[model samples]
Target: MAIRMHAALRRCTWLLALGWLTSLPATAALPEDPFRSPMWEYNLARYLGADAAVRHSDTVVIKTPPFAEDATQVPLTVDLSAFPHEIKEVITWVDLNPVPHLFTLRPEAAEIRTVALNFRIQQASTVRAAVRDEQGGWHVGSVHVEAAGGGCTAPSATASNPDWADSFGQVRGALFSPVGGVTGTRLKVQVMHPMDSGMVGNIPRFNIETLELRQTANQQRLASMALSESASENPLFVFDLEHDAQQSGILLLLRDNGGNLIESRMGI
Candidate 1:
């Protein structure tokens, strides 16, 4: 079994390297496919460091209006109905955001067939909401965020990031306010972060780290492995859950490459 595992690991590594070649367009000047499908990029393997694949779906709707005036506060929403069963996680990503992964939520108490939340858009580009079902299949929906900026590179509200050392959630001893009636509390948990991609060098030579949401009460995780660059800056994760009067829950998040951990408890 060890030998087979090693061989499989080597094969995966080889294929991952080839993914870069496959992503390049036939032309050097126009390397980026204007209509490139996010599902085809081997992102799960290349970025998230996992071998995740997605299945496209029209049922999934990535809600972003054609125009947004404020780059700092833009509303983004996602809705998928009668979605496939293979789905285990749902995520909304900005193709142009410095990091892309804005926020992702797992079905804490429900499958979360729909979501709605306000997000900061950094620029105009194709955004996507990708879902990984229980069966290990992926479903995705993309949208366009008009010209906006200031989100991807914003500094932390306070000085240095708290010494939570990867801890995530509300401020110390903060109470959780559960929302939603129809679908129970439509909870939207967010991690405070810049989600800085090392590629970003505003002045030059300075690099920002990647941020991500890592875990939840739900058995299935969002998009793929714990969150990563697939999200946007200061990721605001919107999701739904069943109202179990007898249940208490917490949202576990990892920051900067999914290493640090934090917990946000749900309020009654």
Candidate 2:
């Protein structure tokens, strides 16, 4: 009887353990690709790393034209206003472009709700914006754009102009009142550069490598971004910053791969 009771007790303990395991929530499987691109897996591993925890998220919205009229100047807007979690970093890329990586933005002392810029597309490609949350999970948003091709290889308009060097590294920026119900300042900045992709004949790749926005008073960095050759020439960047005071003043600093630095002040 003692042996039988001991055996019964062991069986009951095993059953309890199994029940507890079954009651716990199941781990979520990765979602299916919405764009169905062949390079999805490869690009994901290449840019976001092989072991990144990724999922398709509606909160991370990528707004761009379905058909790109000019592949060299296709506008892209990444909106993270609806994302519930705190963002650590944002990376944008074109899957089929010769230089696939576009830009990586790390919000240091600012709240970046939206980021807009123009980029070059080699062909009809899938564009992706991957936002990394505080928990290290990457939420991805993707869109497809149809193009006629040759955007990356084509010579920039700035390259053909003889006087381009005269205005090179010039920065023009303005701070406007917030629009579209957003409660922050809208900063639009245009930088003059050839932004050569080196794909064009005899034009070596020259582009802005790093950009920083800071408080003019204390030089406190608000945000910083790293750009690549995939960006368009004379890049126009739009950032929605949480800082709205015109008196606080904002400083723009840009650096190129050739060791050129441009600095300007706005909202003074």
Candidate 3:
């Protein structure tokens, strides 16, 4: 019995070693590039999870500068008036932003279409804007924003928050405001989260794991940005009015990787 137990332990050890070997990066760089190769698989529709039937439609327009002088506060705009009842929602993403999809703003009605926002970029990167039409179709737009510093790995964690450390990956967030009326009426929704690259480290553990936003918050979600580390710090967002936002109902909600929710409410 003693010999059998020893053999079992040895076999387990070998398996663990092999698993680690497979996971280890080929190069021993301080911080490795998350992208393995150039011909990597990448499809925005599949990545953004629009739908199997959803085709790329050129129905939406994104407004932003061709280049940015400051990456921290790159301005962006999207007009919904061009879209009729077909616009489901409008979404934006800063490829280099620490948390791309800086925020997802959901409109209450198809009538309300224009939106303007500011996002921070960590470095020079491409920015994408997508629109979800009324029939559940998706339209996309792309731009490039340049910046000097990246917001990821920023020493901006709040010590009071519990999940601040693991917020490296994408986080799920929302902002809801009653447009013209309350409950079931006109409303706008937004999401806040980090699109972690999994290249960063946990200061203490020095370990890396798959960090991403869960589907629970994403499926019910109207739109999202597959962001990188180039996004800004404490992303701020806004959208046009559709429904009547009542007092105490206006708010921006966010949850870190551990599912702790933090909300900021506007008194209206």
Candidate 4:
């Protein structure tokens, strides 16, 4: 009986070793454990599939504040301009949030390779950005954000304000000169909406469903993004305007899930 027990233990050890080996990354240079959650394996298997291979990439930059003063409105930026060729789509999420998937952006124009948005973080979480290339390979970027917690379940700030709906869908925008030789116009835009995630209070999910940025002079579409309930109230976006935004200005058009439309322009 003792010999049988010893053999069972050895079999278990070999299975564990096999599991770890199969999980080894396709690229050894890139670490695979960016999620850092105890359920990282489970989450990746569920979200990315067991057969998916993700490569860590410096070209796909994920930026977030080290500490979030307001967890409900934590800022996030994903830039893949460094590898600006044949990007299929970009997916972003907060690993620890109740609603993990924040947004998905598929740029109609290849020149628009960056996205900036605000999202909620339930607690300390690793924010992730994954870009799918033309070949279907995914390049990933991640950042750790520290928060005080309750961002997801907290009451909506817009619901409490009482004046949010009056300006719902109104977009205010501005352009700023390049800072520290960034070589692009800093385009900042804010849209008025509650962006209620439905996790807080009795609020049902009412948020901006889609938004597009266009050059006002030529009406050329620059970038478009889809936002979900994971977005914070009064969603704010700041992005790099490459060429025409400074000269021709830009227009922001957005629509909420409730079928409300908002359009505004800057530098017209």
TM-score of each: 0.54, 0.87, 0.49, 0.77
Q: Which stretches of candidate 2 lie over 4 Å from their true place?
A: 1-30, 179-182, 244-246
Which candidate gets the maximum TM-score versus the true structure?
Answer: 2
Model 1 off-target regions past 4 Å? 1-55, 84-86, 102-110, 115-122, 148-150, 154-183, 189-225, 229-235, 243-261
What C-alpha lDDT values do all the predictions have? Answer: 0.53, 0.90, 0.47, 0.77
Error of 1 at 196 (Å): 5.3
How are the candidates ranked when ordered by TM-score, highest leading? 2, 4, 1, 3
User: Which regions of candidate 4 deviate over 4 angstroms?
Assistant: 1-31, 38-51, 177-184, 243-246
Range of the 10 consecutive residues with the lowest summed lDDT in candidate 2: 25-34
lDDT of 2 at 31: 59
Better of 2 and 3 by TM-score: 2
Give the residue spans of candidate 3 off by over 4 A: 1-41, 48-59, 95-102, 108-112, 120-123, 148-231, 244-251
As for candidate 4, its clashing pairs are none
Better by lDDT, candidate 4 or 1:
4
Cα deviation in Å at residue 123, candidate 3? Answer: 4.4
lDDT per residue for candidate 3 within 1-268, as digits (tens), equals: 9999999999999999999999975632122213332211133433456232333334466677777666445677776656645555555666544455544545432134566655656666666666766566556655555556554454333333578555533324344545555332222333344433343465321211111211232222222222233333344444444333222234434544445555444333
For candidate 2, lDDT tens digit of each residue in 164-213? Answer: 99999888879877658756777899999999999988888888999999
TM-score between model 1 and native: 0.54
